[model samples]
Target: MPGKLTITRKISYDTFVQVMEKKGAPDSLAENIIAQRKYTLSKLDRRFVKELLFGSLRWYAKLYWILQKTSNRDLDKVTAQIKTALILGSYQIFYMSKVPDRSAVNESVEYIRYAGQANAVKFVNGILRTISRRAEYFPKPDKNKHPSQYLALQYAHPKWLVDRWSKRFNFERLKIILNANNQQAPNTIRVNSQKVPAHDLLNFKQSILREDKNTVYNKSLATCLVLKDSPNLEIGSQFAEGKYTIQDGSSQLVGHLVQPKEGEYIIDACVGPGGKSGHIVELSKGKAKVTAVDFSLAQINKAKTNLLRLGHDKIEFVCQDFLDFTPTQKPDKILLDAPCSGLGVLRKHPEGKWLKSPRIVHNMARRQQALLKHSLQILKDGGEIIYSVCSFEEEETIKQKEWLEREYKDAVSFPELSTRLPENYKYLLTKENILLILPGNKYSMDGFGAFIIRKNESVSNCRQAK
Candidate 1:
């Protein structure tokens, strides 16, 4: 009876706790599970629950520190329900300007009581109350002496990541990236050109702008729109009709880089949920021969369903590992959107702050190297491959590119990639023609590293030529 968590009648709070307890799950999965709960939540209540769940996750470390400072107790030793309630309460007290501190403290104290954590109610109240009063005076790790700890606690990033990144990036730049990761990411959509022509989408933008000023056309991307405050897109007629697909501007760039021709065959390796594959179809005006591959059957099935919904049915769907799957026909181009540590997109998936470790990044780099090698094998002579990962880790990006050039004498960096980029975005391209998109750039895009490599000859030809 002392430490048991009781399901309270407050639907939103109960759901928030339930979602919080699902450790190691992706943020999206947690959101789905929360939505599937039996309780019917009002629109307002749903928003509150999501804010608590995601915001707490985003600032998990910072909230924990604040609670520890206020309570002078080892939250590590407290029951999880008590800690979660305290974190939720501290998030509102310190971060949510719209929420009254009194309300936050009361709700947390009440949730603890309802959860049967009678011993923690007083502890939770004292912590939240003290935080509400003296949060400004609370101490943080010294920036000079404990830079990693300071940045981690101040920005809610993993200390290991902060320490690792600090070695590669200057302090100012690392701080910029960390701060950007803590901010709300915009919802970017790639207009399905087949369904909504540029002129039609322009008209739709004007209409939506009339309703929501935060909605605006992307300056550099002709077929992209960004919503700083996104509405319920699933309910919108335009989204329902497949006029646009929810994708980040960073990912939309991958489609542009692929530049699938009308008759060219393209392979999207690691086609998770098929966003880029669908983009290829739209870019090619539904004329490119495309094959989407993923090792997970669930991912391939999801891609198949999504592509079909977007009116792209001719594309092949293969549920096999990219390393083993070879196409019957050689592809003119390949888009190896390989999986990585996902350190680049931490803003969108804040759970990574808690879930990811340096070891994960190192392990992922090894897999990426293998995927790149196998992809080169299946490509035709002179065919190009856009090697991409949603990561900025040196091991995954520059090192992988270097390794390809060293291992395969025929592999050369694409020469004309600079000419393909929009004028404004040419800055994203390095002198070597690699696209290095950092999170805190003016585009507000996720961090990503992509480079194009062309197989100058067949493997046997390469050997003979050497």
Candidate 2:
């Protein structure tokens, strides 16, 4: 007998498709849903919702590959709504253990009916039943083919991405990167020393999960605390208390790279949601004249909310594009956490494989170039600038670094990263002043890159540096 439908999970699955099919990233889509309170979901309900939604979208490429084999014609010929039903059904059939196979097929057919795809009911049932057989439904990837093709099929990742990694990473390492992206990332938070010390957080009355076992690395981070198996810190009581900000280890390193001193004027150009800006304030002991700016008013508002929550009263927020907005005064230090293809955080945003590509990577590089060039205009001649992106694409990292060094020549100098990053992070440096973070178990950090350059004081007339 078939189990009764898990209606909430069904609803969640549909919404996930509604948003993700249009290319919405899971995090933002979930946030919008939660904020709107479209339905009252228990914690477990929300978890299942996320599980089904993320799982289907995360393994999109491979699941579609499965569907294509099970179908007579190309998958492109399938209607979007029916196709989503198939993907949802396939996720439970192959990936989910708790969902009984019968329940998976039955519940999916129910979704098809609810979607008003009564015509697809038999089609959905046939495909799902065939796939539920476990052996016959999913296609076996042939390893004898090129490693890129095998990895791409095995991991459900885009072929281009697989090909790109295969060339740079050995087969074993590439597999690690692909697998890690499919795993749940740790919930790491940096304690806001300006508001409360790490020790004080222990007594905050919230259910504290175990601290990261690597106490030495945790200590080396100064105030960062690693949490596993904890509630979403984004809305947890501790987060509300402004005790800490949820940030990735690699991103937190960007603050370390900035290494802002007391009384220095710093610009967090492109401060999205304000994670790094808050770190800057905390690092400077709230003494740095921090100006946080972003092009989007929405992003600027997020920066403001984070700054307010973290209890900083001194920073100024600006909702203006850094490319066009001229600063009142040249900042002594600038951190351009410029946007890029976000290739580094794929573990967090699995849809990236479907939503982003090499073309987007090249386009972002051009935008980053423009942002970097314009940012130099507002920095003091001798001031330092940190150009960082959450991408390891050569164009965004090394190529951009090369471009800056070429454009500035004697006017700009690249520093060695070892001089700034902690000992554990020094190995991440490819040169004196750049950090290319690889995603996976190594550091469990995102794929990120950063370059620090100092404007030449001798070129003080500096308009020529333009």
Clash count list over all predictions: 0, 6
Q: Which digits, one per residue and each the tens of the lDDT, describe model 2 over residues 1-466?
A: 3245565655656666766567786757765766676666676777787788878877988888888888776768777777878888889888999989888888888877777778788888888888888656444667766678788888888998888777788988888888887877776778889777657755532444433222212434767666644445346456787877788888899999999999899999899999999999988898899999898998888888888999987889888888887888889999999889988888788878788866888899899988877777678888988889988888899988888777767777877667778887788888545698887747687789998978876444443533
In candidate 1, how many clashes are counted?
A: 0
TM of each candidate vs. truth:
0.91, 0.92
Best by TM-score: 2
Off by over 4 Å in 2: 1-7, 33-37, 137-141, 198-220, 230-236, 458-466
